[model samples]
Target: MQALFILSVWTSLVALGCLAPFVLALAYVWVDLFRPHDVAPALGQLFPFSLTTAVLTLGAYVLVDRRDPPRLGLLTALLIIWAGWITLTTTWALYPTAAWAKWDWAFKTILFSTLLPFFFRSRIQIEAALLVILCCIASNVVCFAIKSVLASGGYGRPLGLIQINAGWGGEGSTLGTYAFACLPLVAFLQRHSIVAPSRGWLRWVYFAAPVIAVIGAFGTFARAALVACVVWAALLWWRSRHKFMVAIMLVAGAAAVVPLMGDAWKARISTSFAPRQDESANTRLLVWEWTIGLANQYPAGAGFNGYLGNRFVTQDEWGEDNVQEGRAFHSIYFEVLGEHGWVGLAIFLATFAVFFLNMRSVRRAARARPELEWIGDLARALSHGVLIFMAGAAFVGIAFYPLHYYLLALAVSTSAALHRATLSSADRAPQESLADLAVGHNAARLPAWRQRAGQTKASI
Candidate 1:
């Protein structure tokens, strides 16, 4: 049934793409996020779903969609360089098989993200793209939340759609991080979304989404999610006009949710504060340390899956030497440093920095313009989402994930929209001023003309 439904949706969207090319773009994002093939193996055997969607999306863009090239800003440039650097590093990667496997999808993610701003130029297009992403993510989030509420989810449990506890969606920590990161976007969409209808019970679904995302994040029992929640709250409070009310609500919400958390969840989260006490946390610390040493030894980096070569020793609680080999970096920063080297890490950081600046630029440009307020608000939401993701990424190795790249693309699109709007307004300003001046000049002659007509009427 699931397979039939998914196929129906995919076919419908593909057909719709002929009339509206942006629909194809949305279809691609849907396939990427939902991974319908993974959900049903029978579907996978039929054809390559992801590759087909990508090809269709690109074809639609070239053949049907209007080509409005995005401004090649610092962010885009940085992303391009970053992509190139990672590819170059892959050539020297110690683990060639693993490196190439990662590079295949990673490069595609970068390329698509770079092209996203071009496809979504207008407010409606941009909002629709975000809505599609949120909905896809919510599918997993809703399921995870329901299971958590019913079973009181535990650490290492697979609460999402996929049973395997690996990759972005299946992994608890990464899923939890994504859940928190999406809160800001959810809030933005609820208020300003043009694509979503304002009337009916559908509107309330937006309200429920954030709550479900929170539950799902808690359900994962990930310390990274806890940290992301804190950062998300702080960013929300900072952006909110009613800081006091937001603070109160934050505190009250936390109070309400805390009691619902299981003992296992509390214990796992507590380990974050005292890293040495927990074996996992201790291992992460060791991995990060090893990454730093590796960075110094090989400044050029060991490329993707470089951690496979990592070997470290640690003393157990019993004071016995234990050897740990082939452990993952577990940190995005270390993952990049280990895989792509210092140069790639620099490019990665610069790209995000540029994204933040772009959002700031949009906010400042849209500040006083009431018509552009939605753009400003969206920019804030994207920035907050990015900030939360960055906080989460400190603990999770998601440097090359599609989520962050999507957020970055949205930021760029918002900034680009702001610039185009500003320029159009500027072009109209002179014409409007001249029309006002001509109206005033005509009004100034009207009284004398009326007096002359009155004198002529009296003489007649």
Candidate 2:
């Protein structure tokens, strides 16, 4: 029954995409984030949902939605270069089989990201994309948040929609990271949403979504989530117009929530401050050390899944030595460094830096226009979300995850939209001014002509 329902919904979305090509883009995002195939086993076996949507979306873009293509900017160029570099590195991967498997998805993610701006060219299209992403994220985290309240969450516990701890939705740390990172977008929707009517029930849903997301983050029992929350809060306060009030609210909210934290949650978060005390934290340190050593041996990177060959030793609290092998690189920086080498890592970092600058430029340009204030707000929200993700990614290996790439694509789309809107406005301003001047000139002559007529009649 669930499978049938999901298939029906997917079919309906595809039907809508036939009329509006951009709907295909949103449908693609929905498939990526929700992973409905994973939710329903029958659906998974029947066909590849993500692949189907990707093909449909690309086809629509080429056949119908090619009217206004986005400008090929520096950010897109960097991503293309980055993608090419990673593909080259795959030839020398320590684990060729594993590398190829990862490359299959990672390359697609980069390619899709670059093309996203082309599909979403307008403000409404961009906002709709954001809303879909937010809702998909919420669908996973909101459930986890409810479970956390009913049953106090523990580290390594399966608390999300899925019972596995693998992908973004299944993994505790990654899920929590995404939950907090998405908070800013939630706030953006509440204030500037055009898709959802700004009146009654939907407004309340927007108001409660962030609170639920925070709870879901706590439910993961991930120290990374806690750190991300603090970083996001600080960034939020810094960006707020009423800084003092925001600070006060933050403090009051923390005070209210702190008492509800379970002992397991408290214990897990405290370990973040003292890494040496926790086994997981200690393992991350060992993995990072191994990655650095690998980078020294292969400065150009060993390719994707290079960490598969990692071998290291760690000393326990009791002074016992334990050997670890094939441990994952927990940090995004190290993940790229180990897999792609230093050069790849440099390219990856450069891509991120360029993205941040793009968002900054958009915000600055949009803020000056009263009508485009929503664009400025969207840019701010995206930047904040990216920052939060970066903070959390310090301890998680999601370098190739769909979430960050999607955010980058949204940023690009936003920058492009601002550029187009600004140009359109600039083109109209001169014509409008000239029209106003002509009207004033006609009005000024009308009274003088009427007086001349009256004097002619008096002379007669």
Candidate 3:
């Protein structure tokens, strides 16, 4: 894998030169998520992929792009504020050493999040990023499936039993959360490709992506993922123009898979309703309650990565499960509350609030432009994915996850680009073909305004 990373780096530099750093940065983002460590161990540890790529991308953007600097959106501003607040709170953190380390990791995540909008200038660039991330996810899914097959039918259990990492690769619930968040993007791309026509191979790959993603989510055996996937699928089906066909496909897919699911999967899902019987559910509830207690006690905040160690000492007095190592904040809301206190939590929520609002504006702007119909579709898909993250994060510890912020950055860029497109088109309306541009007619027609205006005056 190290050799592959080396080859990839060399190839990018040779083929793309100035643009290579930014491309590698985006590649790093995807590779980091997939974490193909088994295939490439050195790639996992040797390179600081995201940070290095981000610095290189920033340099390239400044020197070569020659365009206006990317505008920082409301979400980005809030994130900056939130990061600063987290850093400030680290000074008084219960565990200062751990706090600083946690702060560094988080700073890196926010750094790349801030850079993405600047890098993604056009609709094609945005689509490329989405496709790349989806393909990375698909690769992870395929790997998990391969692992499960080799392990001889353990797909019904927590994936961690076979693959014991965390984040995208390890934790079943985390992987499930990722799959759920990405399902909308895959579906949107697939639908758009079919309607507008794209490369045949690319369209087929998009078409199969959602299915592979669904399989990946199911393999996780994560209840939150299951719920989120079901909700995401419904939203996609409703938003799709071919509702009946989508419905039939969905039903047929379910029919083929249902009989194959074992009792273990059924039992695992059933635990969602009967939480009393589920040890994991009980532990999660205990963790959430402990987090709430911690928030109330330490109104200022526990600081970054101050949970487990502090919990060990404080849990005996305040927690229900005094002996158990309290899991890190399971819910994003609770996570923020516990780690950052009221002010941090408020900023965190506000960031997403502004992000969703921006997406709405993007969709509205796209609705106004016939040439940018895909922008409207993408905006909706992004919104749905955001909703899924918000919902799924109730069960997953994704308060600091890069994917959510990455999507927010894209939303910011999409809205900004669409706004610019609308303004530019309006500015050019007097010279462009007015009738063809109006009422959602063909956008390819050239301007005939001068001749038409002259003929109209003559007729009058």
Candidate 4:
């Protein structure tokens, strides 16, 4: 009990540190949830990520590898060396101001790198990571719900209630981007859980939480978020055709009552796209065209920072300071082209191509390899999340965002680790018994989800 409490507290605090709007700002959850968590050692504190932990894990890995070394091959070497190049290239981006503008990316990267590796080291670590993510989602939802009700005319103004946490990341709606990303995984796990059938409150929470979240996301008045929700719903439908149909009917029924909200909802929705007709759209179009023209002018492009610092000068468009830092091409593809030219754009696309292909392959591998099943599921979900976000948001920013790169690294490392463990297990399996402890765990866990999943009423 003490240990569990300590662990809960530890995780709750970490969850708050990495994610805002989490319930940690409240005190009672500490006593109620994290008693065992309280005593648990800091995950970062132990498990060797500091200069100290790195040296120790390295030493331990070397010792273990010496005895049971998995053969390293050309592909492994290339991937590691490539990641090193990426890290070096990313570090070479010397403009502190530019990096600062995208600090959200940096923090996300740091979070992924600092925490994700623990999953590969142990099943406990994998479960812990998932738990933290889920808890963070649940906690934040509860907190934001309470605060929104208070700020509005009670819950009466559900459509009007919005969280404006400027400190976390983006203001209003952009802050909800991460939550939108997490919804699919939450939906998936909730539907499959053994408790799905038995837990009445959870059933309601699961059914309503994502809907409420989407509404809350809509309330942020962020068109980007609305677009994200649509895209994810599409993907979820693609994942299950039957559920897609059910979703369509439900959404259609909800649509029938939209007139009741009066013109306010319609006005807000219309206002989001209205920007497409105004100076903002013109500005974006101008930047995109100018950036592309500059790319054609310079073979190596205008140089990485030139997009912000010199694109205007190089293209001879500057008379006054229009932008604060002179950053150009808000779009990632255009940014790459403007800064690094066609070659840079090529490299960037190739990198994403590699990440995408690797993600697909890993997802395939996860199902094929018993040892890798859990990690595979996680990788697939994360990969899908990344795909969903990048598809909708690639226009907004570049890959300098640390979370994206950090997840790629985590994916690569864990993929290698999973492959190694699976091969080893397979080699020894024929000589001994075909299964072990984890097989049972997987069996116990899989059916619960499968059974619930079987009952799913597919809809779009």
Q: Name the Cα RMSD for model 4.
A: 12.3
Q: Backbone clashes per model, in order?
A: 0, 2, 3, 36
Least well predicted 10-residue stretch by lDDT in candidate 2: 154-163
lDDT tens string, model 2, 79-140? 89988999999988888999999999899888888888888888788888988898788877
Query: Residue 217 in candidate 2 has what lDDT?
Result: 86
lDDT of 1 at 310: 74
Model 4 has an lDDT value of 0.49
Tens-place lDDT per residue, model 3, 1-460, is 5468654753464246354435654665664555444335566477555555556666777777647446776778887888788887888888788788878877777767777777677766677778767666665666555555455224334343224555655666767777778878876777664333446677677666666666677766678777787788788688779999999988898888655656777777888997755666767776777877888888878888656743432232244453556467777888788888888888888988888888887787778667888888888888999888888778877787777878887887788788778778888886566654572343234367855665588799
Our model 3 lands, by Cα RMSD against the true structure, at 6.1
Candidate 3 clash pair list: 1-40, 165-170, 166-170
Please list the C-alpha lDDT of all candidates, in the order they appear. 0.86, 0.87, 0.70, 0.49
Candidate 3 segments whose C-alpha is farther than 4 A from its true place: 5-24, 35-39, 149-163, 191-198, 241-252, 309-322, 430-460
Using lDDT as the measure, name the better of candidate 2 and candidate 4: 2
Which regions in candidate 4 have their CA more than 4 angstroms from the true location?
Answer: 1-115, 134-168, 191-205, 241-244, 253-265, 271-276, 297-329, 335-341, 366-376, 413-417, 433-460
Candidate 4 is scored at a TM of 0.60
